[model samples]
Target: MLNRANKLKLRDLRLIKAIAETGQLALAAERLAMTQPAASRMVSGIEQSIGAPVFERHPKGMTPTAVGKILARNAAGLLKGMDQTLADVQSAITGQSGAVRVGAVTGAAVGFVVPAIQKLKKTASGADIHVDVAPSDVLVEGLLGGEYDFVLSRIPAGTDPRQFQVRRGRVEVIRFLVRRDHPLAGPGPLKTADLAGWEWVAQGLRTPLRQAIEEAFVSRGIPLPDEIVNTSSLLVMFAYLGSTDAIAPTSREVAELVAPTSGASQLAALDLEDPIIINPYYHLISMKNQSLSPIAMQLHDLVYAALSGES
Candidate 1:
């Protein structure tokens, strides 16, 4: 019996993908620059190696079987990875002036990372920037796994600080936001008690930011609101805050940038009479011992400077 891993080859995977995409053996064979008989033999070999029928043949075309679908999906991933590898090698040959992969938390993505990339592009037009916006914990995981060149987000608790080169930036003060027309919106500073009557939109319970907000309520002696909308999506939170009188706690930068662009532009930050004192600093983190590509290093510096308020 042939082992799955040992029998699989790059050319075979490519042929599988081409067959699945074209649906006709003749078309797929033409694309691969092979004779139809040779393509048929190749498909037969793959099926024999796997001990299963990979496709269902009909008069018009072919359809992938369940096993075939799984193989095709994996083939696509493998091909993509190979393409990225080739691109990276080419970038190395060209002296590191290519793609720079970066990840960031929501606040940094909007307030810092995007702006920095825009500025970098003016001079380094040859650079390709890919940015992922995710929660701090998720971004940190990507940084540690070598999926990202670096990340503009805070390191999670319990992570070994020695594993990363961390550059800490300004603390982002949390802001409580509500619609401009909300009943609690007024000239006088608003108290937590004033918000007790309204519903709230909150991040997922497991998130650090949500835990801090809950802590703030406990410290203020306000019974945590039982009525809450829990979600990780900022769009959903802002939509609820704008359309309804729901209150939410977020970074000041997020509240400022999202409110105007969200179409429901009536959202405004509240002046809390007793403000929540949760300020999480942003950190630019890269792998500890690994040297970054020159392009990636330049992009990292740009992001750090922007977040740190340096020229």
Candidate 2:
């Protein structure tokens, strides 16, 4: 019997990579210069070899199911290394060496990493960098897997600072929000009872941000309203905050940027009138036997610099 890892062929891996990048099968096939049928067969063979279909075709042409997305993402990393040795690809051509791979916390993407990418573009132009926005837990695991050179996260309080080479940084603050047209969007400072009546668009419970949110309600002796809408999609939450009376609380910076663009943000951040605060968002890294590519180092400095002015 072939070992599972040995079963995947180069073609299968390439197909998965293409599909992942294009977000559909036909587009991947076109990019690969293969017939759609051939592409489909290749994917099928891969699935059969692995004992599971890598993609599910839908109205969208193809969408990676949860497992498929992860496998595809992993496959790209594997392929990135292989292309250099065999074909001398540009990614490998430019580097001829290692590059920076970072896993950033969700909040850090726009507020920290994005600006860092800008800085890196100017200073370490030759250094290749890859960043993905993921929750803190996923990032920690990726760091252990050698998938991430470094990470930024909002870890639990008193969590071992040495565990992931924690970098001390301040937290990003967040608050409750509602559409500009919501009844409570008016100027009065938010009373705890005012929140009890509405549904909440909450953050990932796995995050400290959510914990702070829950604590805020609890501190007021208010029961979390039954209409809790939990999600990690900031865009979705922003859209809801703009279009409906839905209450979506978000990071102060993200809220400020979108609030003007969003009908709700123009309203107000409810003053729960409490001293509660979210956990600090810290940068986690692997310091043991660790080094960053020039680009990665630039990104690291830029991350701190960008957020230096921010909370």
Candidate 3:
């Protein structure tokens, strides 16, 4: 019986994978930055231990035997699992596991995510969280790939949830924003034409809400300003709004970051009569590893409770 210690390990699996990938011993060695002799030795060592000639020599290049093909297939799965293990370890040591790695679209971070973390801290004192703020599509990808334990994003209008294991949480409003002193802050009816001259800070043009809004302006033959901003940075946008006459539109939950100081409301949120509903926020989670640590579970509950309080 072959002792487990002498059996194929990560190194052997890597050698086989490299050989399969490059299709030649000399080239595989070059790809791995090792000498041809070293590569040959590795292949021989594996063959001796496994008691099978794993590869066939041909004029064109090397090819795996039938048994070698089976080994390679199994090796791929093993290597993938090993890679996941290493990544999980790194993420946890760097503060990402045994806890929730939550992702949110840009709008939710400053106001909703930060405050929600604070609230979760009060109860789940020992839990850890790693938060990522990104565009909706990116965060959803992370959530689906198991890189994120949970995620927060609005369901874009006309979005099909079929590809995701979605959990609808709650609906929320988004509105246009301007510095309180801006000319339209106390306004009655300001149309797209009012925003023609000044550079406007907006979500990416590809985003559903932003795209739809821009389409409306274009359809009306209103010439958009020369300036276009594409950052999901709320604080930066808020600062710009505070400094100049720029206006930003975002979610109500996200807009909570703008609590005015000194009895001066530095910002005022506006509802668009022809406004677009940014999206409906949901508690998005990965389909993989349905098993979550106690802490991860607790964090999810806290966020759910906080949103529930609003209803």
Candidate 4:
């Protein structure tokens, strides 16, 4: 009897569910596309296997016994789960549902990736997307370590270019940010030389942003700031600027994003005598041989289109 109970099939569950819903063997058989005689045989088999009478054969229709009700309830739940599982699988195949992990530098995250994600969500609402914003080196490491599906960053100088596929993105313009009440904030045409005396907030040495700032000062025959607070955290940078007269350099995109027109911003961009533009450094990159999931590929294409000004 135990072996017989273990042998119950999905079709058996469906037949029981149909019978419970319709409350008549003839009607259940019609719904299942089987003859009444065949349905009766299946019912007999189920009752025999479980060693119980599942239903009472009344003159008008069938009524479920206590055991039958239990089976019917469980069958409905199981069938509903099965149907949902099938739907999820179909959604995944169509690129409408899945997970995508993207890495980007802060500037690109603000200017490009954020907008692309907004558009993607409107169409593929079931797609799960994660965006990581960091410096170029960190983004590249995440891409290589399988932590990100793709990254918007430059390949580090010494790494093999052949290890990944790349599409060149736009150049980034760097702007100096200071507290709204800082001495330089009232600017009429301030040269790089004028910024030499104050304290400065900057990234660590050898990073691209740091290198750009150093070149900007050295090219103008000006000395670097006397005191420097080295950090990569934007929170720390903003906090430091809020209380002191220090200057922080950030991409124009990030500067504009954080400093809104509402005038509530604690930081404001310094209108420099000369604009500092970083070379076209960052790119849309992924491992050469790795294939992205359907959903990840969809998002990757969306970012690519945004880079090309197609979207």
| Top candidate (TM-score) | 4
Q: Candidate 4, which ten residues in sequence have the lowest lDDT sum?
A: 185-194
What is the lDDT for 126 in model 1?
68
Give the poorly placed runs of model 3, Cα more than 4 Å off: 1-98, 154-163, 169-172, 187-193, 216-223, 259-265, 281-283, 308-311
Expressed as tens digits, the lDDT of each residue in 41-66 for candidate 2 is 88887777777667888887787777
The Cα local distance difference test for each model comes to: 0.81, 0.70, 0.70, 0.87
Residue 96's lDDT within candidate 4 is 82
lDDT winner: 4
Model 3 per-residue lDDT at 108: 57
Arrange candidates by TM-score, descending: 4, 1, 2, 3
Query: Least lDDT summed over 10 consecutive residues: which range in candidate 2?
Result: 89-98
What is the per-residue lDDT of model 4 for residues 20-116, given as tens digits with 9 covering 90 to 100?
9999999999999999999999999999998998888988888889999998999999999998999889878888889999999877888789988
- Each prediction's RMSD over C-alphas, in Å, is 12.5, 17.3, 15.4, 2.8
Better of 2 and 4 by TM-score: 4
Candidate 1, poorest ten consecutive residues by summed lDDT: 258-267
Clashes of 2: 0
Candidate 1 residue spans exceeding 4 A from truth: 1-97, 260-264
Per-residue lDDT of candidate 1, residues 59-162 (tens digit): 99888999889888899999999988997777655544578899987877888888888887776676878999888788888887888999988778888889
Name the better of 3 and 4 by TM-score.
4
- Looking at candidate 1, what is the lDDT of residue 31? 95
